[model samples]
Each structure stands twice: as C-alpha cells, then as structure tokens.
Target chain A: MVLDPPLPRPMIGRLVVIGLGLIGSSILRAADARRLAEVSVAYDAEPAVRARVAELGIADEVASSPAEAVKDADIIVLCVPVGAMGAVAQAIAPHVKPGAIVSDVGSVKGAVLNALRTHLPSGVHVVPAHPVAGTEYSGPDAGFATLFKNRWCIVTPPEGADAEAVQAVTALWTALGANVETMTAEHHDLVLAITSHVPHLIAYNIVGTAADLEKVTSSEVIKYSAGGFRDFTRIAASDPTMWRDVFLNNREAVIEVLGRFTEDLIALQRAIRWEQGETLFDLFTRTRAIRRSIIEIGQETAAPDFGRERG
Target chain B: MVLDPPLPRPMIGRLVVIGLGLIGSSILRAADARRLAEVSVAYDAEPAVRARVAELGIADEVASSPAEAVKDADIIVLCVPVGAMGAVAQAIAPHVKPGAIVSDVGSVKGAVLNALRTHLPSGVHVVPAHPVAGTEYSGPDAGFATLFKNRWCIVTPPEGADAEAVQAVTALWTALGANVETMTAEHHDLVLAITSHVPHLIAYNIVGTAADLEKVTSSEVIKYSAGGFRDFTRIAASDPTMWRDVFLNNREAVIEVLGRFTEDLIALQRAIRWEQGETLFDLFTRTRAIRRSIIEIGQETAAPDFGRERG
Candidate 1:
C-alpha cells in the first residue's frame, strides 16, 4: 500500500562510469540495481581493476580504455581522479558520438570541465557532476550498490548548455537515489573548496603531523587515538591519487579557503596559548549548530555515533 | 548459558556518580547494568538536571549536591568537568564515608589529582580514572549504558594509594567491558594531551575558522560538509566546559603537543600552497596505517560513506 503516487519512469540511455574505483564501481552497481540505464559500461587503466570488473559483475560491459568506454555512450561519466581527467577527456573526445552527453564524478567540477572543454567535440554536451559521496576505502572491490543512495550530487552545467543533456544526466543520478542540484562551476569550486578540499587537506595535514611527531611513538598514537585525531586519520586515509588531483586542480579556491583556515587556526592557537576559555567555548558551541544543520539537511546522519556501528 | 565460569566480582558497596552529564550518567548506567556495584547514586548541581535524573530512572538515588550524593557511598566518582573538580571534591570530601574511594572521569589525571588532593579527608583514597570514550553530545539524557563498552579507561593511582580501592574501580570498569590500563599521572597527561586534548583543540579551532569564513557562507559550509570538515565539527562540538578544563589543567603537555601540531600544520600549509603533490601524497598515504590500527583496536568503525548518508 503506497501512500504517494509512483515516480515517473526515468529517461536514460547507454551510460559509462570511468575509472572503476570506489565511486565509479558503486555508481555502476547503483545504476544497474536501480535499472536507471539500458546498458552501463565501466573502464579503468589498470588490468587488475579491469579484471575485477568482470569478477564483480558491476557493469554490463567493461571497456578497454576511456575512448572505448564512451565510444557510443549517451551519458559518459568521467569517474577518475581530477588529475587524470584531462588525458581521459582527450582520449575520449574524438570517439564521443555526436549529441552525446558527458559528465564526471570528480570532486572538483570546475577544473574537470575546464580540462574537458578544449578536447570535447562541438555539439557534445558537458555537465560536470560531483556526487558528494565516498568512503575511506578505494579500488573496485570497495564499492557497493547503496553508495549513492540518498546522497547529494552537484551538477554543474555550462551556461547556455544543452538542456536535454542536463536533464538526462540529472535523471540518471536521481534514479541512483541522489538529490541533484545545479550551480555554476566557479561557485561550485568556491563552495567545495571550503566544504571538501580544505577539510580533507586539514585532516591529511594533521594526521601527517601526528605521524611525524618525534615525542610521541606511533604505537602510542594508534593506541590512544580514540580522541579527535582518529577522526582526522579516517578522513586522511582516503585515496591519495584522488586527493592529490583534488588539490592540484582546485588550486585557487583551495588556497583562498586555506588562507582563511590558517588565519583562523592561528587565532585559535593564540587563544589556547593565552588560556582564553571563553573564545574556545564560544567556537565549540557555535560549531555544534552547524552539525545540527547538516543533520537537518539530511547530508549527515542523526545517529549519536554517526552510524559507525552499522558500518 | 554461561560457557565460562562467572568472573569474580569485587565487593564495592555503593558507587555515586557525581554530575549527571554524559560521562557520569553513562558510568552509572553501565555500572548498574553490569551489576558491578551494589548501589549507584547520581548527582548534578542544577535542580533541573537532578529532577531529570529522577525522570531517567537510571540511578538508584539522585541528589542535588555532592555532599548528599557521596555521604554514604563507598566509591564517589567525580564525573564533573575538570575545572569543577576542586569544588565538587571539597563539598563531598567532608561527607564521604571514612575509608571511601574518590575518583574522577577527567581527561587529565595529574591536574585533577592536584586540584582535588587537598580537599579530601585523610582516610579517603583518591584514584583518578579517565575513560577514553565520549560523543559530541553531553548531559544526562545523552548517556547510554554501552558508552564505556570496549573503550579504554586509564587509571592513575597515587603512590601509597589504597590497593583495594584501585582494584575495585578497575574491576568495576572491566565488568562494564572497558579495557583498563594503569599509568602514572604525568604519563597519562602526556599521552592524553596528544591523543585527545590537542586533537580536540585543533578540531574546535578548524571548525571555528570554517564558520568565520566570509567568502564561504555558513550554508555552503553545512551543505558541502561531507568532504571532511564534518568530522572535525563532530569532535569540536564536544562539551566546551570539559575541554576548557582539559587544556587549562594539562597546560604543559597541551602546549608542548600543540607546538608540534602547529609546526606540522604550517609545513603542510606550505606544501598545499606550493602545489607539492608528492609531499601531500606521501604524507597522506602514511596516515592510513594508523587508521587500520584504530579499526583493529575496535576504537573506530570503518564505513563506506563515513556518515554522509542522511543528507
């Protein structure tokens, strides 16, 4: 007994998920499970990943290369790291069918679009998508069908771009159970710079710092990491290639936000050094509100332990 | 039903958990559920909290003052913030039953002991305990009986301290399923300053900085928080009063570790600004091992989405 009317039948054609890593493989599985596409093809450079593609049964077809993956695909998703997007775009541009739509699952959309704009053949639609969903794990085997369920997927379509292509990509992600939002690439970079890149970089930096500490033994760090450092380590443990490309491609926005972060951190350092309990308390209390808002938006879980137990 | 022989139970007459906050209430619940103690009493300074204490039906007895709570208790646990330990100890010391045990749930052992040592009666044994378990939430209702399960509890007993009292507390925490470890006060402060205090302070600082960014709106921060800052906000949102006391009490250790953290953060900041991909990748990769160790120790759970599913 359904309370609401049934959802409309989704509109999607042949879809391709590039660089079959955690996100890529997950999207493939998610699309197949949701029946979002007639055919889904996955591609990766590494032979092992490609071999695992056959083993996992994620995609209907496994392509030899980026070009092969998008040869006849209507919706081509560049699921590789930001650093590899340029080369993959170059390789696939020549083979992209006319009227075909191209999108990506890259973290930084602005850079990805910029890299692909020159190589992409005319009349082919390009919509940069960032499925704001991932895990600490990587590689093909790490993916699951439920990865994109109820997550946010930001679609950055170029100004005055093909409306149909945008609609097709949006529908594809929507069927995969993601709430899609469209924004300008520049705005997306700036927003993501604060929300994703800077936070990840900070986590990486803190964990790196902890690792390099001379006074504290690594064993001690691991044993006593039930504290705040463990959370950073979790974030810091994400795929290195993905993060490297993220920082490289989103340089300007990352730097700008990082400047703000550094200044704020220094101010906090001063407060701690001076024993300013009021400032610390005020900041701590204020951040709690932000967490609550995230929970409200349904971007983060409301569980007390953040659903770690189920995971 | 019991495959193994029942573990020997220590004879702990009555345990009073002062301040029905996250730690206190949780300890009371866990102790009572495990039948680790004959009786469990809870106390909070605020009448509202005391009234709610009765409402929760967790404690065998609820009291508004430390003196009333510890009056006839065999073990009086000061579960209040580190800053308030002195006052709570003073009020309860005179009323604590002769030969009773006095302990704490504060992070910093040396400071808590120093703060409350002078206030205790000659016969009352002081054994400082720091159970390394918590969430961002606080207060009586936030506590759960399983909060201390599988967590680490560091106990620091003074020289010539009552062996029986220390053993009883250790046994009780063990019964509650916490892995108990004993260390000197100085060592405990140093370890915690790095593992908990410094990391928490850094998290609070970073989140505050993110909140203050003018170019990036709070809405943007919350919307895109899935990348990494979300984890920091969770850690930073921990009780302000409790953390303030932690930093204030463990000044030297916190300062020393904080200095190391700042130096490391600066180096990473430089690397990011310079777009040094190798350095970032190398540093980021090394942190993964620590995360694996944490998962192995059962301190953290590995997740595919790391709690980004709700949104």
Candidate 2:
C-alpha cells in the first residue's frame, strides 16, 4: 500500500501568525515545510524578531503589523502572551477578514477566550487553543519545524462557536503534527493549572531557594546538580513574563491547586521530621506508579534517568 | 599514545562489594569491564540478587555473607543503604584484614563515617564516598557499567586517615570512570543535603500531592505530565527505601536545608498571591543561569527538555 506525500499547506487561504516567538515561529516554519497555506504571513511586535523572521524566510511574508498580517487571512493565530491577547485582538479586529477563524496558543484558555470574545470582531469565529508543547528556550531562533510533533493541542470553542471554524482550526493543528482534542475553556484552565502552572511554580520557588542560600554557595549547587536540582532548573528557566501572566490569569485554579500542594507538602514535612518512614515510603511508592503511567501514556520516556545521556 | 584499553580492573587487589543494588551492581560491572581489580567478590541480603549477580558473571564470586566476602580482600566496598552501614561494618570488622581499605558509597557521609569508625577494626583505612550518579531503577537488572561515566564521586576521608589507603580508594573510583574529589564528612553531608536530599524530598512531596488531589484526576496528571510535572515524577520514582535512609541518616542537614526551602517557598507564594509579577520574573530569570552552568560544566546536556525525545 502507498500513501501520497502530505501537502505543505493542507488548508486553503491566508494563514496569519501573530507573534514570532517560539510557538509562532514554529507554526510558520512547519506550515512552510508542507506549504500548508496558499499564503502565510507573520508579525512580531519586536522589530528584531521581525527582521530575524524575514531573514529566516520562515513565512511567505513578514508583515509590518498585526493589522496588516490578517488583512485577508482566513485564520489568525494570536500566539501572544495571555495578557497581550485582548490588545492583539483589538489591533487585528479592524483588518481581520470576515468569517476568519481566530485562535490562540495561550496556556490559560479561559482568560484568553474572554479576551478574544471581548475584542475580536463578532464575525470572527473565536476558537481558543492551548498547545501543550514547548521547550524552556524562546525566541525565533529557538523554534523548529517539528516542535509540535506528537504534542497535544487543546481547542476550546465556546458554546455556539462556529463548528466549521473549529474543525478548520483542529485540522490545521493536526496537519502541523499535533494531536488535537476539544474541551471547554474552564476545564482546560483547571487541567493545565495542576499539570503545568503549579509544577512550574514549585520549580521556580525551589531554584530560587537554592540560589539564595547563605551557607550553601551557588557554585556548589551547579556542580552537584546532577543529583536532582538540575531538572527543576529547566522548568524554572521558562519565560518569566509568560508564566507570570498564566499564574495571574488563572489565579483561582492556580491558587486552588497550590493550596492542595502546600497541604501535601506540610504532611510530608511532618513525616520527615517525625521519622515516619512508613508514610514516606507509601507516598513515594504511590508516586512511582504515576511516573509509569506517564510513560505508558506517551507523555514521558521510560528510559532510566530521563535518557539524559549526551546524544 | 595508546592507553592499553584501560585494563579491566587496573588495581591490584581483590574487590569485595556488599549489597547488589543499582550502585553496587554498577560498581561490580564497571570494575570487571576495566579489570580494575584482581578478583572481585560480592554479597547481598537478598538471595535473589546474589543469584542474579552470579548468573551475570558480574563478580568473580558471590559470597553468602559480608564477612566471607571481605575475609581475604584488600578492599571492601559497602554499597548498602546508610541505615545498614553500621551493621554491615560490624559484620565485616573481624574478617577485614589489617591494611585493607574499608569504603562505602552512601549518599550521607557523616553518618556513614561515624558508623565506619565505630564498627570497623583499627588499622583498616576507612573511606566514605558518594558517586552522585543513579537512575530511578534499582536491583541487579538495572545496573550498567557506564553508570558512573562522567559522574562525580565525593570521597570523604576521616581526619588523619592512612594516606596509602585513601590513595588506593581514590584510584579505584577513578579507574571505574568517576572523577574523584576529597572532602571532610561534615562538608560532604552539607553539600549533598542541598544538592540531593532536599531535592528528592521536594520531588517526592509534589508527586504525592498531584496523586492525592481530589479535583484533579490521577489520569489527567499522567496524561499531561510533559508540561512540567513529569520531571519531578522521575526523581520521585527513585528507590523509596534508599531515599528514606538518606533523609533519616542526614537528618540535621536535611532539616536545615528543608527549612530554608520552606521559607523561600512561602515568600514566592506570597508574591504570587499579591500579583508581584516583578518578583516572579526576577526569580525565573535567575534560575535559567544555573541551568546553563550545569550544562556548561558537563553535568547535564544543553539539549532542550533534558534531551527527552521519543526514545
């Protein structure tokens, strides 16, 4: 049996990518690889990023502004921070072509959906999405065509959203090498709060602690990081503004999960202080099973030591 | 110049290893691969582990007891947990010949040193070391010869120890593919408390929290772990018994560091609650440099996401 080579651009009409950071740049590069659109244009507020995008030829055209980028586009993916969503929608609304499907790759879906609904033109089909894929690295140079391959892209189309628009957005993400699923913005925010936001918060807090220690020098932490602290640093090193926005926008969910995390931590602290070996053992043993489940579900590698050997 | 393929066990002495778990079995396999010892013997509390070691030909002989394994050996390595150090030392004291170097690979040095000094016979050079390398897996089946390659081994020799014995112990680890450095037992504990013990405690605590959540399902935690939580689960999945022993044996140091960690975490929590975006950004940006230094020092790869790919 034989299969035809996937076309570069599976979707028709213009695809305007706003913001040329890691996610936005990757989207353009991937679509260009397969010629996924009849026309591709991108805009980044940062002139340096815009110039770099022009240099890389990542998109068919680099627009001078968001308004210009989506002038005749069938889809406009606002890959800006959650805080920037409303402003970006406002900037592009006047120029967004009627019947265009508007989406985003923000982490906080509920807040982003609110912003899109508030500022995007009534005719624009609002389809807020969260692509749960990224590296700590950011910027145009940090992105690659395969960044979204095998990653999950959750599309949250509010009630009464255009079904055709939602389908078009899902199909676009699928073609970009992602697995797409639909859920409400509220559920997406809650799920991500526990899965991503709080974990990142914990990592950031710990790394900060390690750095600010008085007796234990920072040099010592870096030298012996292979012990465990190094892994936390990777997540903690993620884009600061982006994460800050996530925590602020999803405050209720983040606070709720963080409260649970604090309670569990206090109990473990008590166990350690009181020498309750059995309690620690039970908890540790249970957590090990979670790691196996993650590996089995294809979210992580089963390789020992995270397969961290130089490759 | 040719290096003679680094003789499989270049040291001229019989190596007796007690406890055949991840670290123990790795030591045996590495020594055998390089011929770093003349003849190697090992003993484990578990008969199944002993049988497997013999089956794999990991050592010259699998002894029935620690006393028997160290009877005629010039060097005896205690690879058991920190809590088991004292009893194992007592068992081998009468059998360990004078001038024989007694060493251990426990993570907590101060406690292990105290155990060695009290239980082992006089004139037996005592060396307590930690090869800051391991995977989540344990047991003989999880061992590998290259486990210590490019890893750091902290050799904490007691004050006024035999120079010759210390040199022999250092040579053994260096030949087995670890970079060896010497420090006092007290200092090693303090450093490891921050670098390893507390980090593991946090990982275990977070995984436990995520699992015990009422609102967030365990299944969701596993499915979406790639966002950030998966890395913590990796560290948390480490052998529970080994970590429990570490925390107990290094109680003072662990408590001290854990205290600082709690304080810092509380401050971050406050900042988050108050919407102090600058505070969060400052911490997130600073942590990124630590990751860079770890990668630059060769302890970790600069690869995005710890180089965790489909493999």
Candidate 3:
C-alpha cells in the first residue's frame, strides 16, 4: 500500500486559499497532492465556484467566508484578481494568525506590495509572489495538480520583509513544484511589465481589431485564425478582470513599456510601408534567435505548432 | 498492407513540389500517403533538403532542379519564398508540361497571382492557392503528412481559368485532408493581411522589443516568456525569408491593416495611460468571445495551455 517514500512536507500547518479561480484552486490541488501543508482551507466569492471546489474535494475544508477560512491558518494566500487584492486582504487580515505569512499570486507585484502594506494587519508578514504560468481556461475546473511543475514563481518581498517568512513561502512554492527567485517589488513589476503586461495588451488589442473589422467578418477571422492570429487569442482569452486590474495597478511600468512597444511597432510599420525587406529580415532573424533560446532552455519548443495540431 | 482496404486514389499523374520546406514537403508527404497523386516529385533550392527528402522517401523522385522537377508534371507547385516566387516560376517555366496546371502555397495570393501572370509561360494554367495552415518550424524534416488535416486551403483561380484545373486542385487538397474554398485574389490578400501578415508583424515587433529592453536581460525575457510573451515567440520563430517576403510582397495591404491595428493599439495604450479599466475590460471580454468561436468551429482549442504543460 505504501510503496513510495513519503515526501518532506513544508512547515505550513494550515494553508488557506482565498479566491478559487485557476491559480487558487491549482494551489489547493498541488498542496494537497504534494502534502505541502498539514491541512488546507478554501474560500471563493462565487458560491458556484465554492460548490465546485467542494464537489471536487480539492481542499479539506470549504469555508463560508474568508475570515472563517483563515481563522487558524499559519499561511494565507490571496488568489483574487489584482483589483480585489486590497479588499480581500483587508477582510481576511483580522482573522489571520498573529504571525501568519500573508502572500498573493498577483501578476504585478509592485501594486500588490502597496496593497498589502496598506490593508494587511501589522503583525502578519506580507510576501507577494507571482507564478508566471497560466492557460486561457479559468475557474476551479480549469485547475490541475501539476500546473506549477517546472514553472517560475517570483517572490517579491519588501525591503523589510521578515526573512523567515520569505524563506518559508519560498519552501512552500518549491514543495508545490515551482522554482523560486527573490527580487524587489519594483524590479518584479518592471520585468513583468515587459514580459507579460504589454504583450497581453497588444494581443487584446489585435483580437479586438480583428473582431471589429468590417471588411473581414468575425467568422472569417475565426476560420482562418490557425495562421498566426489564433496564437494571440489564447492569451487574449485570459480572465478580463485579472488583466484589467493588472493594467490599472501597474499603470506606470505598463505605460512605460507600452510606449516602447508602440515605438518599435511604428518603426516596423514604416519599414513595411517602404518595403524595407532587409530591416524586416534582420528583426525576424533576431527574434527567431530569441525564440530558439526560450525553446532550448524553457523547453516550450517541445511540440511543434504549439500543440494545436489535432492530428 | 495486404489486410488493409484498398484506397481510392485521387486524380493527377504527377505532383511536383518545388522547395522542400515545411509546406512544400508536407504537401508531398500528404499527397503520397493519401495516394492523392499517382507519384509525387520534389525539388528544393537547398541541396541538403533535396537529399533529405530523397533519403526520407517522402517523394517518389527528388529532382536536381525546379525545371527538372516539373518536366511532364501534371501539377507543378512553386513552394519557394514569396520574394523568390517570380524567379522560381521563370526558372521552371521553360520546362513546364504543356497544358499543365501551376499552383503555389503562398500566404499572399494577389502578389502570387501577379507573379504567376507575369512569369509563367502560356498554355500553363496558374491557379494560386494558399493553404492556411502551418507550424512555426521550417525545413524538410519539420513536415508531417497530417499537417493539412482539417485545415483550410483557399484556391484563388484567376479570371477565365481552366475549370478542370480548379476542380482537380480542389480535389487534391480534399484528398490530403483540407476543406477547400474559392475566393478572388484581391479578397484573399486583404483577409490574409488581417489574419496572418499583421499578426506575424506584431509578434516579431514585440519579441524584438522584449529583447532590446535594457532593464530586463534577454535571459529574463526567455525565462519568463510563459506569461503571454511566449505565444508571440512561437509565431515570430517562423521562417525569416518566408515572413520577410510576405511583408515585402503584400506591403500595401499589410501597411493598410497595420495602420488600423496600430490605431486600435494606441487607443488601448491611451486607455491604459488614463486608467480606463472599463474600456480595457470590455475589449478583453469581447476578444475572449472571439477565441471561443475560433475554438468551437476551428477545433484548435484542444490540449489546454496551448500544449505547453510540462508534465
């Protein structure tokens, strides 16, 4: 019955997951499977999602309220959208254990850091984290136990964050199958602004443009999307509330990066207009090298066609 | 083989594929495997690709040159890059079989149509086709027989073209597992500009922007690419020569579409700058609907996470 060796459980005695969408439910599933905590509790604003999590038996307890869920928890992970982080943290702050490590899974850490500093209780330690992985799908059903496998989780701890709390949170992510790296909140926001936020804005804009084109019907766009356009649709399909908050909260970094991207795109437009083949060729070649490196190291290049090929 | 049911072969005596790249070799493999043609012949400008196609036995014969490849071929396809299409047609024109049907797998049809009309010899029917399917990978070894399965192939026959040639080409695509539709060359270019060309440009431009960020190193960009940026890199990694030619040949349409996309992007960028959450949210939600439609009809939504799950 017990053929495999027992895994070393992390020191988190009670792990509370607030907001039961993709990231929240995934954390619960991973913590349960990996035995990262002694017991797990969950709370989602949506009753339907709470019911689904209960039906799936993803957590040991499905709480009626965030306060009830984190009443005795040693670690509380806020899993709500970035816009809801401040309120969620404020609501659960009063119930958290005196030395509880409060953390969040927000894409933009600088804003979350400010939110945590403003809303969370003084005694509860705040260590903001961002797991740089997702699918277009959302809700509890979209979560899987291994979603974090081989993914990066950047922990953006404040300058005066508790060292023990930060280390413990890092161990928890490691136990849940993520590689953790520590950085400042400002640096994290700048890096993510370039990597995730602006790219998402561009994708959302293109899909919007394609849909609104009078000359090309939306059906035609859908039919022929397999050629390059569909690739953007995947990321564009990410939860709107989450992205909306990301842009609002990380306004400065996003605007800064968006400005740069706009400049590059305009230059490209000029080259295309003037039939500058060599310029286009050079950029395409350089970008191809970047993808090659991403594929080789990140292993994102495993399946050709991004695995869209059904046959 | 003896126990298997005999397959009904599609018409056409010889299908000659010029340029053994992803689409070219894929056609040869699909044709040979489906018995769509009695025999398939191929030639590539690159000697190594020719040798590999011959060694892989993907084609019945691998000729030394495009001219040799199309001699007596019933269907001759110029599969070279779009910029090279005119020259490829001119090179193979002298040896083309009398009354033979010539076609292509270019992304932009109007330019290809013009190239065909100008360079192809008389008595050789030119029916430019764009099979709206591909993986990011290029080269002979990257092709598979099932690449065209369930994909769409747009056949843009010129005015007053031979009816039998169009029907035979449609049948060939159907046999190789594609849904065929016919449209004018002008309409094809416009639709493809929105669907494929502009999207490729955005992908290329963003990847370049990410790489050139002075604050975030390239390694960081690649490592954290799973956050929306990785999707762009997949399309950006496509063949440089092919994409450069696509931009050059389809410059006016592409520039026109890019102007619209840039306008939309700047609007979104302004929304972000001014903290227009509702505008961003509405656009993001609408785009999600577009992706759902693409998933429903195109059936490209298989395997969540765009098949980037590392389990």
Best by DockQ: 3
Each candidate's DockQ score against the native complex? 0.56, 0.60, 0.62
- Point out the higher-scoring one by DockQ: 2 or 3: 3
Estimate how well candidate 2 is docked, as a DockQ score: 0.60
True contacts kept of each: 0.66, 0.72, 0.77
Give the alpha carbon lDDT tens digit for every residue of B170-269 in model 3.
9878877889989998888889999999999999999999998899988889888888788888889999999999998888888888889989988887
Per-residue C-alpha lDDT of model 1 across residues A1-311, encoded as one tens digit per residue: 11112235435678888888988898887777666777788889898999999898988999887777887888888888899989988999889999998888988878788888978988789888998878889999888776666767899998888888889888878777778888988888888888788888877777766777776777777777876668788788899888988888888888887777777767776777788888878887887788889888876777775755621
How close is every model to the real structure, measured as TM-score? Answer: 0.93, 0.96, 0.96
**Lowest-scoring 10 consecutive residues by lDDT in candidate 3 chain A?**
A1-10
DockQ-based class of model 2:
medium
In what order do the candidates fall by DockQ, top score first? 3, 2, 1
TM-score of decoy 2 = 0.96
